[model samples]
Target: MSHNAASEPDHHPVSTAENWWVFRGPADLPPPPSWRGIAGPAGTPVAQEYLLSPEDVAVVNTALHLRRPLLVTGRPGTGKSSLAHAVAKDLGLGEVLRWPVNSRSTLEDALCRYDAVGRLREVSLERERRSPRGASGRLRYRSRGRHSDIGDFLRLGPLGTALAARDRPRVLLIDELDKADIDLPNDLLVVLEEAQFEIPELARLPEDQQNVEVLVTGSRERVPVSRGTVTCDNFPVVVMTSNGERDFPPAFLRRCVRLDLQDPGEEKLRDIVRLHLGDDALAEAEDLVQDFLQRAATQTLATDQLLAAVHLRITGADLSRDQLINTVMRRLDEAFPA
Candidate 1:
């Protein structure tokens, strides 16, 4: 599962090129300048150069061809979330639309959000301006604006905007789906299948005025929606990750192409350490990697743990190597040991 073998560069099929083109950004709108800085705080494009096993590459390609959401199940810190970022960067899909899942998450939260309180305040202020009595005397009430444009109160959430984007398919990351409510995954079935969602506030508008422009993720500008409904020309490359916290409904699973990420082997771990730390740290990193392998035998040992410990050592942390291992190389399950 080397990078070259996994990427399958030699097999230049027409479908592969077409799939690659689907992720290219629109010609009219250049990607925001902020992306250069935001994508990689440390000079790397977020997820662009991330290593993928052969199985992962095959599964991703399949998902791209079928236009289905890719559901990734793996241990925590196995780069599940990073995979979304990597795909977006490699494909030139601008910024990733990330919707983090939690116990209270709902399908509505991922679609669009309405600011009722802000709308009400606008109404109240408009009413006050139109009142008969003023400090001086009664005068003709002049309307500045129509209460407030409904678009002002509506903002598309990550998923909604991704679907609405008229350009290339956006990369949407539904992080940690296992942490969400049981009903959340099941609720996503229609949205995932139909590739669209409706906003009630916009739908209620007159037919003549239903094309409202609203803010969404990615661009600083807003996009127009017809009749308050958002439909995608190209379905988003959705990546939903799970840490094995719970089971998803079978119906939901059937719609998605699933992949399980394998834990990195010692050589892969060495490569990762070399990527983050420098070549100078390899000799020391090898020793620490061995210590981490031992901890992994009994419990979860994320790649980040090894990176952190090595970083501290290389930076001349005042502690001994043994002390650093003891403090930073502990098992991930130590806090909640059974």
Candidate 2:
């Protein structure tokens, strides 16, 4: 439905099946209320709780306002990644840029690659073949070293995308930074501090296009990033997550706003299940989910296992309880063998 500020009250709350829509401002065009605390689909509304506390919200808000990176630490399945998406949605920004970290990851892995050398070779070969001597001229072709046009192929990486965003700040999710190598985080400190990165390839390009975009993430890998060395002058919002594996360098910790995540309570879980699964299966799924969680708590079952059981319990054939349990167990066993 269209919202006009002139027609509607300054704050009019409309209830829908999923969530409430709040409108504010002028008649011609009214800006939708920020979805900071609200939960639902990207633009559509859905009923979901902000499981984070007020203090946590303040920390996040401060990070966003100042464009500083906010580091979030918590156990697995605590919705750390989801927060990035939420921030983008709340600000009416589009999709988020996600950078998944791994052990072998490097700065080059996250930045653009220049293929100028390859292109130059192809062009030289083509010219030789079309010369007066035809294929025979190919033998006379000089072996001039390939020139690198770093600017042309210097495409933006996840971090680059975040820093270069001009229209609106884009949400960036750097998942599992701990897995990355030592130099990766150190290399990132330069861009994170300056809010600008120079692509060696692009440096030769026109001044306007020489800069690269950037956003970075880190985990409990404990790589050292020295202080007073690099600072984010542009201030892009940064979010980091840790699985409580190890402590980060003190210097890195001092620069960030950290927050912990708590497991969802029954109410919040119910809301999440309903939001994703629907109302009809909420009751049955909750029971199965709780049982799965109980088992998981004692062992080290992945979150996907619990979700699988819930799915089977709600959507599987109308079998006896024992049969259903057997099906779930079999699936879990296949997914995670002892």
Candidate 3:
């Protein structure tokens, strides 16, 4: 379905069938909404509830319906990264494939990593080995495996692995997209549009020899490839996050469904506190929550600060410790200095 910025969510899961999509690894499915655990971070054993506002739910559902990457922008620690984890958990999509962006991150780095030195070393060792001589000057040698196979030296990165996963539509978190260089967003346009990528090493081989079986980042088994091309049978649910650090190119923005997360209110804060801690801790942190709300009015604060403070209090740490609470409550805007 075609989607515009104003598109509404359908409010349905990606697929209805429980096992509609399967993966090789252990699945991290959250408890039903009626149960205790609706959402939190992924891979947690206990079920904890994470309440999503209707607007939040709409944006997520809209992204799913549109099949476009969700570009999430917000202040630091506003659950931007956690959104991807929540989607994966709720949808039974298995572990999230995360590519944390930095100032030096490149598009190729996220697609695949080739160990050329390792491959060269293996080739050198193979050439140096001599066959043992049998009786009557006959040489006995074991057959070498496909020593020239480029797949041996190639491992798909998280983004590429998510694209290559055939069983299910994996959740790919391109966290902190603004941390990347200016060219990064434009560079992603092609891959995002094509839903496939070519490996130069594999692509350079003769057409007949281009087919190889390769291992991906998150899978135990190898997948078949042709001409070193990795195509997506099920396009991954991509969630790209930014801290409102930089302006993206118009073309890049045009391709994504954007959402700007707002600061959490007292009720949501209480829910988040309860999710991490328990009912008793939630009650104890009420005063702290009010203080947080008052401070958040003029300064930037992350949800994690509240969580940290509550955790410390529950663990019997002295809240009166000098600079302890201050350290936890430090604002990102202050640290980065605009």
TM-scores, all models, native as reference = 0.82, 0.64, 0.79
Clashes of each: 1, 12, 0
**Cα deviation in Å at residue 151, candidate 2?**
4.0
Expressed as tens digits, the lDDT of each residue in 232-290 for candidate 3 is 89999999999998999899999999989888888778776765565677787677788
**Model 2 over residues 230-286: C-alpha lDDT tens digits?**
222234456766666666676766666777776655665655455444465567666
TM-score of 3: 0.79
Clashes of 1: 1
The lDDT values for all models are: 0.76, 0.54, 0.75
Model 2 regions lying over 4 Å from their true place: 1-55, 122-133, 137-150, 204-235, 301-305, 317-338
Candidate 2, residue 280: the lDDT equals: 55
Sorting all predicted structures by lDDT, with the top scorer first, yields: 1, 3, 2
lDDT of model 1 at residue 114? 92
The better-scoring model by TM-score among 1 and 2 is 1
Candidate 1, residue 191: how far the Cα is off, in Å: 0.6
After TM-score superposition, what is the CA distance of residue 77 in candidate 2 from its true location, in Å?
A: 1.8
Worst 10 residues of 1 by lDDT: 8-17
On a 0 to 1 TM-score scale, where does candidate 2 land against the true structure? 0.64
